[model samples]
Target: MPTLQRVPALVASGQLAIPVAEALVALPADVLGRVQAASIDPDLADTAAFSEAYGFPVEGGANCIVVAGRRGEDVRYAACIVLAHTRLDVNRVVKKLLDVRKASFAPKDEAVALTGMEYGGITPIGLPSSWPVYADARVQDAPEVVIGAGLRGAKLFLPGAVLAGLPHVQVVEGLATPTPDA
Candidate 1:
């Protein structure tokens, strides 16, 4: 667990997406206290590049994805969190979960605008209240995981359980499948 000094305090970072600082602070100390948010090279914002450049293990990185599902005239949005090595089960499980006829990744620009986070740094922490966060069970089982800090130049390091404990977060089994190596 990292104290406030090792990395910028979530409350102290103006670079974070809107309402993230507030949402973070609202989490229980057991969850929030363990988080360490650090600055990074914006160019290394993507998980694979960041891990390679900084020597972080692939197992330690989590990827957050935003998706929009349509059920007839109704549209719903959700956020999915999974290990970097996994592929999100968007078309199958996600569509069924959302009770929608179709489900797809949200457009990058739309996701950024809706979440108030940078394109590569969109996190589940400060998503619109209407959006639910679905975390892969493997993610919560991890001892620790690295994720974006709502800013391209920053990253968040925390116990995976902390993320699973967030409000509106549901730890779902098989939310992702292992990715086949290319």
Candidate 2:
């Protein structure tokens, strides 16, 4: 059986992985300064488990994502962030925001391929230059929040104000919700 690879840490804390640490180090000094992360052994696939395991508080963290769609012959990609408490209206809000006939979550494989990061590890800071990112206003209200650092088993804690400073990050609202099946 193949052995699972562990993440490296930016700092020698023996907690998270190194690449995640590198990214945190690379963040502009003007942005939120580095903060500590809590280690957990659970699949943070959803908000509840993610919040519970990390103890970072869902009401504070922002749900960042990459959304894409095609309009006629044009394909577009967008980096979007939503608050854990309020879901973005993918159809009504994103469709209108992108001004495309159809909008959908970017294909999982395509996202992983483009980012060179695991499914849950993708973050806006290291994405391709073409990505247009959007952040919700709520993120600006928190003192510190944890977000993916481009890998599972790793996360970065920074002030909410720092995420607002990313280029092309628009303050949006209503990106996701507890759907009947979700």
Candidate 3:
């Protein structure tokens, strides 16, 4: 395991955290210390690569992302967390729930550009302050889930309950469905 930095020392005290990277810095100290970071391909989006390279099962990992959609006049951003074995149907489920005309995965370039985190490494633990987060109910039942460490080749293993404490998370049951092969 790699070195894990405790939250308090890694983050400035009393600063309203932004960027999933900074938010991760706000996690409980004990949990923060349990995380590890690894470096991998910058553009890798699929979980198989992350699993193979990191020695974790792709289908058993957590998939965390921030999505962009229109809600009235606002360009709303919401974080969606799912199991790697399942796929979140952004158009049917996410968009309709947001009451928007369209909701798509944040464009690859846009995701990388805005989060300042690599595409394969986007994790909900630390995300921009403006984004709302949603976690599929299934994830909460897992013994442990692997999430990006805001960087590639690196992932964090934490108890599922920690995700529920995120300020903006809304637990939903149908955010994702298991793939046929899974």
Give lDDT per model, in order. Answer: 0.84, 0.64, 0.68
Specify the highest-lDDT model's number.
Answer: 1
Model 2, which residues run further than 4 Å from truth? 1-26, 32-42, 173-182
Q: Among all windows of ten consecutive residues in candidate 2, which has the lowest summed lDDT?
A: 1-10
lDDT of 3 by residue, 43-105 (tens): 443577656755666756898877888766777777799988888978888897777887878
Error of 1 at 60 (Å): 1.1
Off-target runs (Cα >4 Å) in candidate 1 are 1-8
TM-score of 3: 0.77
Residue 45 lDDT (model 2): 33
- What are the per-residue Cα lDDT tens digits for candidate 2 across 62-175? 666778877899878887776667666677778777888888889999988877666775666567766777777677767866666666655656677777666557776554
Q: Which structure among the candidates has the greatest TM-score? A: 1
lDDT, model 2: 0.64
Name the better of 1 and 2 by lDDT. Answer: 1
Q: Which wins on TM-score, candidate 2 or candidate 3?
A: 3
